[model samples]
Target: MIKDRFSDDDDGLQPLAYNMSHDEGNAANTETLHLNVLEDVHIFTTQFELTHKLNVIQKAALLLQSDTSLDDAPGLSVHEITALANETTHKWQQPWTMYLTIVVTALGAIGQGWAQTSMNGANLYFPDAFGIGSGSARDNFTVGLINSGIYLSNGLLGAWLVAPLNNAFGRRGAVFAAALVSLLSNIGGALTQNWQQLLFFRLILGCALGVISSTLNIFAAECAPAVIRGGLAVSWQMFCAFGIFVGFIANVAVYDFGSNAWRLQLAAPFLSTIPLLILIYVCPESPAWYIKNNDHYDRAFLSLCRLRNTEIQAARELYQAYLQQSTKHDSKDKLTYFKTLTELFTIPRVRRATVAAHTVMISQQLCGINTTAFYSSTIFLDANFSKYSALLASVAFGFINFVGAFPAVWTMDTLGRRSLLLLTLPLMALTMLAIGLSFSIPADSPAHFGLLAAMIYLFCAEYSPGLGPVPAAYSAEVFPLSHREIGTSSAVAVTSLWASALSLTFPTLLNTLGSQGSFTLYAALNVVAFVLVFLLVPETRMKTLDELDEVFAVPTRSFIKYQLTVYIPWWMKRYVLRRDKVELPPVEGWRTEEYQAVCQNEE
Candidate 1:
């Protein structure tokens, strides 16, 4: 009966003859047998039904001797077969290069964070240095324009400019270029004589930030093992929070510098960038990118060995697996930049991923994070706090933001991306509502200020875990390896555009709508973000980049219909008409002709 279930018709469990002989006459047979075993093992493990009896039987067969017949040899028990499979599937220890890569990328993220948040505190003093009256409309508009310039260049340069750089020179080169620009921009900004010159330098710095932000997470994701990829990739945001924290500290340290304080604050970010430039040069190029884009198989294999802590054979096999999966979606011919960009929208799964990436980026910005981050001190100042007290509150907020990000690194893989977003979005919404409502109380009341401070801290805590890191991690994970650079660039571009709009408009909104209306608008936007994430974004935790392709390639209508049938309550299903049920073909199977040929040749 057991044999009947694993009959010859079950191609997955075909019998294999082991060839352990060292004799010259049997060398051909031994090679053929080795290839057969490798192919069968690959197919069996990749299947979904891991616990099938036939699957266990196949594993048992793999350990058999060539001279012994199945009938003569003692059959392995189910427990023994399961143990073998588990042993086979266990991952190797990650290499030191993996950790090194994480550190290098996080450093780049710190530079980006410094560039973004440095302006937040410096804006407070800009009016004094620029000779504009405090609280004047012209001063507010100028500050907004300076902040908006960074984001505007981030959108344009990240999407169109940095993408090709990533493709041309690899992640390390891109980061190096970004660091150089940041160094120059910060020095230029610090030495500027007027607001106009400072704005120009800030715009240049934004372009550098765009390159760093768009590429660093992708580099981390590509370099890490799949088991911990989410944690490592999301570490970019943690470093970003760290950078912001450092900026806040810099502001506090230089607060007494008077007119020159802002200049010191602007230049402080270079401390992070200087080390980043050197370390990035020491890091290796992404193995996946090397294999796929550059056609340097030997170098890719070596890089894989270093990154995964495995031997040459294992590295080669793994790289081949990655190449096979990628080739299924990528074109055989070389893709130009425009063609790659077009493929992001033209391909079905890619298009869905792009939509999800863009939505998450846009939603994160529209949630009013930039407004809150860039103007927290100003917000407190408006609440009747002294300048020193407001700056202290900003420092506290930055600390909370940095600490909050640590939990996501622990929970991101366990909680799943969609789950984290869903869990946090509503809480963020409520927190914003609380902050808005606090403004309704008299500004002179201690209760009003206390509630406002507490709510702002709570909001930062809630936001850092999900909205801050998950979007960047998710966007990096969702795209195909061939298009990951452009896809992530596009997502960052959307973030910058939305950030630009918010940065440019938030001051005006605060002036016109008052604190209550501004906060309420953010709260409502969070509510809408919740709905979009719930409906569209898919779970991507603990999955490899290639596996995500199949996840998104499943037809949307069919997936929705399946969800309605299986997840919806029976009572709810009864109200739905059978005519409305979507009837679509099942997902196209993953096995390609090339894979089949390889399997057949081995057999």
Candidate 2:
């Protein structure tokens, strides 16, 4: 009878046969067999079941919350409790294998960064070589289109492939496949003889990059402990910044290579892929992926052990992940790719995550970071700097971009995701405005060139720590594990689409609007991005993947209303009005009667 009940369980919970020698009762049987006991007692068993779920949920919550004692946790040894405590107190005290996984996967991001900026110096030399150097409207549009080819493929094809690739190959396998494609595409791009050939290769590169960008962040987030997941997952952005810096260096190095310098720049990013292919094998598959895709508890436990500090810690996490998976209520086999995509918008919790993900991903582009990343050298050359001077200034921009991202390794998990966005978006806007205004200075004056380069550098500094890292990390974490791939892919697709649009039109805009109007337009768009982030995005830092469900469950209107009626007022009183002892009201979750009894207070 108990076996029948377990088989019929909607939550996919296992039977009590795999029992632990703990005092709090077998976690599985407590949920499963307790109902059978109550059936003969003429009791309100449905109410009891609801109360039991709440209790189990609360226990799971404590496992992820810092400063909360785990005295109530079953089967934890003294060493295990100490390990969990250390996770909060010393967030850096992690297993070396976890760090190894972060490094290998992050190399994929570096490859992406290198691929992006490889064309910056090439941009100066290639257009003329390809007969598009006449500076006509048609030529400019063609340059933009060639530059944006990768993003076009990324949006239309690569992003959509993420779900299938991940489903078929898992996170590591998808990365492997993408890396191989990137390697082949880079080689093909370097050897291309014509504009059409170059464009075709770039489109192939974009598809691979789309898969890598969407998968690697999710892998890092899944492998990492909740306490440090933000820091680790943003490794993608940090390494990509480093890669950008190196690509600039490569461009400078190969400038004297004469006619073939552009080809070498195209070839340089492929080197990053070689190391990625070798090192990725050393990293274990994401335990969360294992738990989500199959009933391989032992495999999940083993992966967790490699990633965590202690066996007990791994066991605890493995069980918690299992419980979280059960709550998805549908089997993995039932969730087709299209159904998952549909749920991204239809399910209330998932829809909220989708909104947050799309907001950050789209805003990352609109804030105008890519304007500097893709075309800083062009923009600097336009400001009357010589070719070598423009290259040097771009190199400087790349360095500042890399250095700026270093702080996010600490601040992302500490200041929180939403706080970083709110703090940096205004600065990005102002710097962009300053860049736009710098173009008004007479081109003959050194200050014209100086101010343009300076403002672009400042904008990079502002971007690296916030929008650059937050988008991927935030998108990776916001969705439930069940919908993570499809949801993040959708968000990544939005990013790719915006990036394609920006890349395809920026050169034309520069010609038409001039540098002044283009920078100013992006600055204004940054303000729009800030408003959207403030109104719609929820804070996701320091929360486990499961815990984020509650965070995103709060509707957009509720979140926005709280920001206006509660949080904004408190901030004004406390910070602006110089008031003391003003208390802040907590943001509430969706309060349907069923959830009202079980909802834990949001911190």
Candidate 3:
């Protein structure tokens, strides 16, 4: 070791550690010479890696378990002392500010949910009012275009804006901007007199909703503690399901209002945006956003203190995150939006995150949940239900969708994201297949209608608990802080674009393939979703955002080979064949001790 070396132009900041070598004599002397040169080049040349930060974090968490009195611990306040004392035993206990932030995020989700399913009831009326009720080929395309306008605009324009908005204004500001736009779009859509006018408003609605979706997931994830981050992040999906349920209620309430019912349905979502605008500034800004933007370390610490229950917890996390983020780029290089966007593909770690995010987001669309979300009334009508009955069935569908997602807030952290995807994708495929086959029953039979509705409910139930929450939550958590906004925006764009394609194609597809064939096609796509998730996605539970670098660092080919050669066989022998004492290989790069400690703490 270079025992005591100092830069000639030192400004009084001491070096954290020396880079040591094991060999003695020539190697040691050479290493010392290299270190001396490095010190001369830069005062603090000993860079911090993510692993070093994780190790420090692990030690801090372990401190709560020590028997030594923390009452007099340096830099800890009374509340912070209590907070750390309760952290492991009471994981659910958190600052009210964090929960309030989650509430704001939920409202945003509700607005998007309303935007998604609000059109379900209107689809029954607007096609006729706009003079497209003739059911011709051209009319079908027009209805599809109008229905898909939001998604098309979201994919093409809004999702891409996440990076710029977030970079310039921060998460809270971006969300506030989206809420204002959402309010305007809702009013414009409600008042439109023609399909073209409605389409234009819906396109604008898509832009607002995309920004909300892209920003809030990252916002919630950043504010929440690692122990319960999954639960908080998934609130987006759970409340979105609630929004769908409430949207259906709005649809039913306004259905009897003569020809104005569709307008009322479109206008209902504006109420959710109103509160969002008022409450957004009250919530704490994301600490990660502060760290990523300008190394506003003091501000980030203050933000963390508000989000966490104690100052000590805030300080520890802030320091860990700060060190991890500092290593991403040189201190001298300036970060730009375009450079960040390109890094999503060029950097190996970022590229893997991008790939995994795209896989889940695209799979979310192809699984066909939105097909039902956007047109359940139309689907029910095709089953020979009356117009009034179709709307009622849709209300039921919306309720089931909401109820289905309630379990994920708990399971998302416990079962792990990849596990939930694997477990539910096959079930979704089976349910979609059942829905298609149910049509073979005679129209007059009660079982025909009952079975079709049951299958649809089952499909949504499976989707809500798994795919619905996983896509956005996973995408938000996987990327490094430096590229988070750009990465998540890209993933959301893929989802929106795919949703746009699905929406535009479905009406034409439904006309050509009939209900049975369309459902069957989606069933096959669910199977594809299963295979993609199984092969590409990795589990992300109970790990800090910084620590994920180590997880994704394992090569994809290695991960695949391990699954095929080790994990699959071990699983078959242990679970399927009921064998005893089967030892499975640990996933490459997972810190087993850290995971066990987390599990123990959760208990």
Question: TM-score per candidate, in order?
Answer: 0.79, 0.85, 0.85
Native RMSD of candidate 1 (Å) = 10.1
lDDT, candidate 2, equals: 0.80
Candidate 1, 97-205: lDDT as tens digits: 7788888887888887777777877877776788753656887788788978889888977556776787688878888998898899998898888889989998898
Tell me model 3's lDDT, rounded to 2 decimals: 0.81
Q: Model 3, which residues run further than 4 Å from truth?
A: 1-79, 331-333, 589-603
Candidate 3 versus truth, CA RMSD in Å, comes to: 8.8
Q: What is the lDDT of residue 482 in candidate 1?
A: 68
Clashing pairs in 3: none
Clashing pairs in 2: none
Taking the tens digit of each residue's C-alpha lDDT, what string does model 3 give over 507-582?
9899999889999999999999998888888888877755788777655666676688778899999999999899
| Candidate with maximal lDDT | 3
Ranking by lDDT: 3, 2, 1
Q: Weakest 10 consecutive residues, lDDT, candidate 2?
A: 1-10
Task: Report the lDDT tens digits of candidate 2 across residue range 1-603.
Answer: 011111223332322122234334446655344433223111221322322222222233334444324775433445656887788898788888999888887799889999999988789888887888788899998999888888889999999998888878999899999999999999999898888899999999999999998888888877888777656776888889989999999999998898889899999999999999988878999887776665665577679889989765675575566555556667677877898899988887899899999999999999978767889889888887787788888999999999999889889888999999999999999999999999899999989877887788888999999998899888877887678788888998999889989988999999999999999999999999999999999898777655786687676666787788778889999999989999885565433542344333421
